[model samples]
Target: MRSRLALPIALIAAVSVAATACQSSSGKSSSDAAAKDAPKAASSVADYNPQPYDNIKDGGTYTTAGTFDDQGNPFNVNATLTASRVWSWYNADAITYSPTGEVQYNPDYYSDVKVSVEGGHQKVVLTINPKAVFNDGTPIDWTAIEATWKANNGSDKAYSASTTAGYDGITSVEKGVDAKQAVITFKGVDASWSSLFTTFLHPKAATVDNFNQAYVKKAHPEWGAGPYTVGSWDEHSGNITFVRNPKWWGKKGKLDKRVYVNLESAAAVNAFKNGQLDYTSAVDAESLKQIKGLAGTEIRSGGSPFEYSLNFNTKSPILSEKAVRQAIQESVDRPQIAKIQFQGLDYKEPLPGSAVLHSFQKGYQDNVSAVLKYAPDEARKTLDAAGWKPGSDGVRVKDGKKLEVGYTLLGDDALGKATAGALTAMLKQIGVRLVIKKADDADFSKILSERNFDLFLSGNRSMDPFAARYLCDFYCSDHDSNITGSGTPELNKEITATTEIADLDAQNAAVNEVEQKALQEYAFLPLFSGPSTYGVKKGLANVGATIFYSPLPETIGWQK
Candidate 1:
């Protein structure tokens, strides 16, 4: 049975609340610091103006930092795409984001069905729309939908390890009256299953043979259901450009051409400022400030569901101990990190509350903030109480072993490295030895998957809460979910049930209980929750550009 812990605020990462934290200087009160450094408000909203097509070129390229390589190699059709690029080509079980952080998906535009919580589970029912069609001109129907699942996750023996792994409770996908209606049965009514309604439907004919040979390798095989098709590829440059689908199933092309270029941070910014690129998204605070003087450039501030955090490797004996974990958690100075490390650009409180785990609602900020903050003295006492003795080097030693914690830092971001250094320095003062290692993204992921590090910085961007399902699998004992080989069976069972709960309230309740228990046990440390900043070029109209920062549709194109 799932443990019933206290109801915490539902921050996407933990507890639930819709409070906002103002960015301020490190070590000062948030209110006092924000007052001094805040930027002046814009005088007035600019009038809308649309740019004419004749004035704009049909094909213009843009370069951005951060590689879409994590989206999975397009060369490997058998690979499961994990980034936003995958979601752009294929739909999900459901869409969880909107232009304004709403929880509902626009079914009319994205799907023919409207889903809601019923009987403690999300029932899959459809609303008939005669207009929806596939790129091949095939009328959108239940057969195509069912076939897509079978080819990916069902027993057709074609593909395995799909996005539908989260929807393990799905019993069958069957056709209903005529071809338009479909019935999806589950083992139980699940409110969480509402997340599975926006899946990308594939053509039965294309995937019936072999996905790799027939679909992926072939030049743009007819698979995706979006408004664009895979366009040109530059092997040497490491880029994939997309073109407007002349036969799009949804709204016709709003932007002329969308190109995704993978380059280093400095080069990308240089390209943007020199007019070599029209628009670029996902610019951090420092990059935003660098190009503030560029003509026609405007920086748009927004919040993302992405949570940046520090993971404590349960495999290490010292970290494997509960008291040491708590001591580390207690020592983090969030206010200082927000001001000095993150430059007052990120959300001030890291684990303020839990509502973030459920929805990116506006009112859910502070419920969790009150609980998580720096208590350095408490952290020191906790370490001492745990029988750790300070040695000549000022590092803690217990049972003849030194408390040497390793943290892997990606060399790309300066702020990230600075934050890591600050954390290492702070920990050292408390008799804890922190060793920081530098690695690229791919190597870090490999090390993390192999459970080779004592600690590291990692994050996830997803509106759906299922990503949290992997938490228990990361450290639960004797369980394949135990990626760290340090999981305890009792804690594993507590989190397992949180993922499978059918009732929204009950599931949330269960998750809260597990988090409290995990916090008590110091299972994983939570850091700051913040936004992915972007600089929007003036006069360029786009609706959901940040939605696809890692690469997919480059920008929701509109002329100003």
Candidate 2:
């Protein structure tokens, strides 16, 4: 069996937060009781197990809520969460990450995978299953590996990959011991080799134009190779239906079909209440209220390896000063923000202290306690010391400039609005004006890609427990995802060093060092860490809120 890895942070942003209101039979709030009964923060992968795949009954269509309105090309960096979910359902990777964070070969895609260092060069060999073929009848082979490498290695400016972190280190990719094998060589030792190939594109669609625009408003089922295929997509109704793929070489999936319904959080909650959705992640108080006593529904909650924070654009004139950034970081009360955002949800989180590793993960440390403590007075003092004094309007002014910051809100969702409002009110206490900038719903991805804001509220969920997998793209100066523009040469060097470490323990130590420095410098503001809450149909097996294992389509079915 192939271990399913957690979805990337970008994909998690798409489906991690959909839920509806929950109320008891008597119309009373159930949040208080739920909160009291909530389990402790998860410490190991076993804490999040949903249900055994063998116990599920075969053949049923599972309907769920999705966050993206359209499913873009999975290969494109601009691909939405909905696209990723669909892609994962209809694709296989050469290797997969186990819920316990170990790298393992996918029996469905590869026969074997090995990594070694020869002559100071990192080498990876992947043996593909000769019988495996895409829905389009293209045999899975070295060509697909080469295409994935070229498209993501940063060697070609035309390919718009989500991130070039692991692929950028590759020196070459060639045929391995046989036609079904791929031997990839890297410039040096790279620890993120296993993290690549989560999604594969057909060799025919490897061109720059095809990668960037081919699947904009279209999905080609023929190119996908999973147990399920895209059966129909109703753009107007915001529903996508997936049926079993005839060309799939793996065992028949338990569910014959699955449907993803794009909905706003509120509508999703109502849909769940109306028995339209089998599962919905209820993150806010309102959504939690609506699903409390739904028949045959179970609420599953566990720590998520997701980090939500305020990303500061270091290039902004008003925020160029480290003091100003530090002041802003200290002024806003994270506990208060979490409180307001999760109000009535019966959930509260501890202050997060690391950008890379979550508190629930091993080697976790609170490195930002000194700098991140909530202190509006200290923030005012820091601004004053930095030569910013209060003006008649109560906003700080330095050199004839007011201390103002712009924040981009990606959607008009209630949670986002409440977060922005809370942040605006909190910043006002320390003479900082937070200007809320709402991005057009259709242009959200564009605004994010253009890095068009002073402070952007976003989060990334770690797909693997290895923090090194994210160091390059999250903080490296050359990466497109480093919106902060705060990457320093020293920081980059340290982060790069982690990729070269062969031992996991040493690599993690180096990661901790880098995270500490980044947090201390206020590279980004760490908010509280909390678990994702989900209301799942009681008998729906092999699926629920989890950070370790993704709910595999083949294993998802109705419980007998």
Candidate 3:
């Protein structure tokens, strides 16, 4: 999320790298994506400078950085935000959504939409624009749409689709009246029928062999069908370059070139200061001070979809015990962590309550507050009841084992280190020993994949506004993007049924109920949903910290 990761349609949204460690798309797919008509979060909740195409200059290169390439997979659940953002640049988009939840058909691809429910099964009809074509001159038609659905609908284990969320409900995808139209039929009444196909996969990539192997070492520009195409992918430099696509049928992309350079925190901030980067993250106070008021910079900020939190690994011997995990979670001071995190920034949010929805969003509930409160005495009692008694070193012991867990401290950021110190002190209050391990910021993705740490500070970012559907990713199991060992098969099965409830309010209530049950496990301790703040090289437009506004590839450029 913060560095490089695929942000899914829902984001697969990675918590911005600006948080503690690299956080990524914790939101994948769920049947209940809250509701389209639900109250929207205020625009003030986000602060991206809103500049339309008319306001942007026509020809300037815009550069940013991240860990990208996506292993060549178009929709890997673990894809980084940079990859998804880049994918948007080179792919045909069928839908356009606002920072709030309003949706519209982008006329570049889709011409009409018709909905119906026949014999209790929901069916949708979509017409692709006759003029639309892929970069290779293939007509953008129903076959491309069908290919995306079949690859992801869980029918074929062979295809490496991200998640089977909305796609799994589809019973069939057939050609409508002509090659330009698609007819989609779902198994039953589906609440989130419109949530699928915001973007498309070129039919060629959907083939079993190509779907799995096509994008590994190189990005196939000919398979892309958007404003920009992959120009270069330098493995040695970990840099990717994109140039305006000559084959694009839509309006020309404003920038002549786009690039994502992989850099760690210190170098990235330095790059921003040196004017090498058009956009840089400044989530912590130390980083914020660097670019806050440089002559050419403007601090663009808004409510982040990312939630920074302390995640507990249930597989660790010291943490596997539910009581120990519960007590450790209860003892931490979230507000204190917040105080340390936002020390200099003019940002404050209610301690994050749910992994599903941010506090500013409608249908959000303070689920964590009631379950894990700041109570040291009670946490001590919890340990006492579980046969953990204070010993000679004042650390709790259970059956001759010390009640200690290792925490991976990522990077040299002062705020990150300071919060670790606060965490150590809080654990001491309950007679638990917290061992700290130091690692370079670049080691974040490596450490997470190998499950190297017992305790970690990470964020779960969301890309779409209707996050209720992502509960399956957050709590169902640690199969895909979810790294915290916090799910059970029984709970996952229950969550699937709960998300499919047709009534909006009832489904949200059900989603919350399921999440509360999951949080009771104490795997992920929700800290706070911090601001997605960035330092922008002044004059940059249509890009900054906003929730659901994925820029129309051509619109992100220097202001005129």
- On lDDT, the candidate that comes out on top is 3
lDDT of each: 0.50, 0.70, 0.71
User: Of 1 and 3, which scores higher on TM-score?
Assistant: 3
- Residue by residue across 210-276, what tens digits does model 2's lDDT show? 8887777777778778888888888677678888888888877888788888776667778888998
> How many residue pairs clash in all the candidates, one count each?
51, 11, 15
Please provide, for model 1 over 113-159, each residue's C-alpha lDDT reduced to its tens digit, 9 standing for 90 to 100: 64555555544756434565655677767766566555544344444
Candidate 1 residue spans exceeding 4 A from truth: 1-67, 70-82, 86-96, 100-111, 114-122, 127-166, 201-221, 281-285, 344-352, 355-373, 464-510, 543-555
Better of 1 and 3 by lDDT: 3
Instruction: Write model 3 residue lDDT over 1-560, tens digit each, in one string.
Output: 11113221111122342322111112221211321222224323656677888888888888886645535554654444555666776777677667755676787788898888888888999998888888888889999989888887768877655566768778888988999999999887666555568787888988887776676555777877878888887888878888998877777888989888877666788998998988887756777787888988898777666676777888777888899988988788666666666666554445567876766666778678656666788899999999999989999988898888898887666666788899999999999998988886556656665667799886555656555467766676735545676789998887787656777667777777788888998898877555677888888888787776667888888888
| Runs off by more than 4 Å, candidate 2 | 1-14, 17-40, 43-53, 67-71, 347-349
**RMSD for each of the candidates:** 7.4, 5.7, 6.5
Model 2 Cα shift for residue 150 (angstroms): 1.2
Per-candidate TM-scores read: 0.74, 0.89, 0.87
